[model samples]
Target: MQPSKLRKRIGGEDDDGRHARFLQIGVPRGVLRCRRGPMDSANDSVEKKHRKVLSDLAWAMHKLPPKTYSLSVEDGAQDAFCDWAEAYWEKADQPTTKPLLAALYNKLPDHATKLSGTLHLVNEYDPDNSDQWHPSKTIPLSVIRLALAIIDCLVVEAERFHANTDDLEAQAIARFKELPPVEWTWDKFKAKCKDPIRKEGSKLWTNVVTAMRDAGIGEVTKSKPLTFRRHTDVDGHRKMSA
Candidate 1:
């Protein structure tokens, strides 16, 4: 059967990926357009261009393919991405709402993935076992390259199904890769990323606050305490863990 058309929804009720979420796979603005309302409507407002830029990053999270990037992503993963895009956009504070232009800018600089610089972007596998898993900040570039390759492959698959009817995942990928207006670069991956990358954190926080506020007079909110983890560091490697 033909791949099902990517569904397009609008207006997330402060829930996970809701509005326009189904189109998130690789459609432009699908991932970045999570913040609701006209002001956030397009993230193109003047005020939207005045936030901060995070200097470093560290990320770790496990995603079961079907759960991480597919239909149910809105249930969790999509919200996670939306949070990052929104948060990063505020920091990027640029006229456009796309966070990837800022988030991945440094990602492809010359020799960037090489062994240099104290600030590092590292990804670890088996994050639960100390012998097999734990956040590692100083892994060698050779190791990183392999990991990155795997990630690249996964990402390609992750967004493939979001391709248009006339487009196979490969065709879509190739077409989007060379989109005119300019040559492809880490900075201009905006087209390929399809939409603004979601801000990092807030969706869950917003839910919690909402729950607390809704409790009204004597809100007896009971849930795990929100824990804080720092993923950014100036003096050493900045890691990203989801």
Candidate 2:
């Protein structure tokens, strides 16, 4: 469960543009209007680029050995330089080799100030250039940290899914208990309720169904009336569906 690629559907053609119109007054400028206050965060084209980089990083992490994975680009470049020096420098004199080595070593960028430059140097040394020479652009530490945190969250969720499906079922039961007894569909429930469970976004239906099954609520049969029910005693042991 590496986070399901569940997409949400918007009703009309303006569905995609609706969010943009809400957050911005103009098209080209994309100026932040903040009609809905601080929650109306602005979206920019750079967000896609950042997402791609993080996806690449996560993919690379999956393939490589954890102990060998180096977040610091400079470290990888230094290792490459050492290997190159060992192989290429055969009969070079100490004076010539010393300066050559020093020059190569100095080329590694200062990590604290120039992370982008460090990544550039690493790209040059990498035969595969897996980052595709695009790391030259300065990416903020905040973005990188946020990406890592998301990855960590997904990995943890995956582990939990395997280990504690029962726990999730219990949680769903508990959440259902908090709400008034009602037949509910995810869409209707989310619109009417401000409960944290309903705000699960794209995976709301999946989660609700999973919890329903785990709690032995009922089977999901597809028909004209699409509904899920809470088996509560509120209406005298009667099942409620929505």
lDDT of candidate 2 over 1-242, digit per residue (tens): 11121111212123233321221111121235845645422454577666776676656534543232233443354444334334333423345443322332233222112443333333433335664533333333443343434433443443333233334434555665566656666566556544554445535456556546554665445433445665554422335598
Candidate 1: tens digits of C-alpha lDDT, residues 1-242: 23343322211122433321221234332124566555654555444433211111212232222221121242353344334335534644666523333333223221223322212223334333423433443444444344344434433443343322223323333333244432233333333443322121233233323332333311223334432211122212233479
Q: What are the root-mean-square deviations of the candidates from the true structure over C-alphas?
A: 26.1, 20.9
> What's the lDDT for candidate 2?
0.42
Quote the lDDT for 192 in model 2. Answer: 55
- Lowest-lDDT window of 10 residues in candidate 1? 63-72
Q: Best candidate, lDDT-wise?
A: 2
Q: Cα lDDT of all candidates, in order? A: 0.32, 0.42
Q: Tell me how far the alpha carbon of residue 207 in candidate 1 is from the true structure, in angstroms, after superposition.
A: 42
Best by TM-score: 2
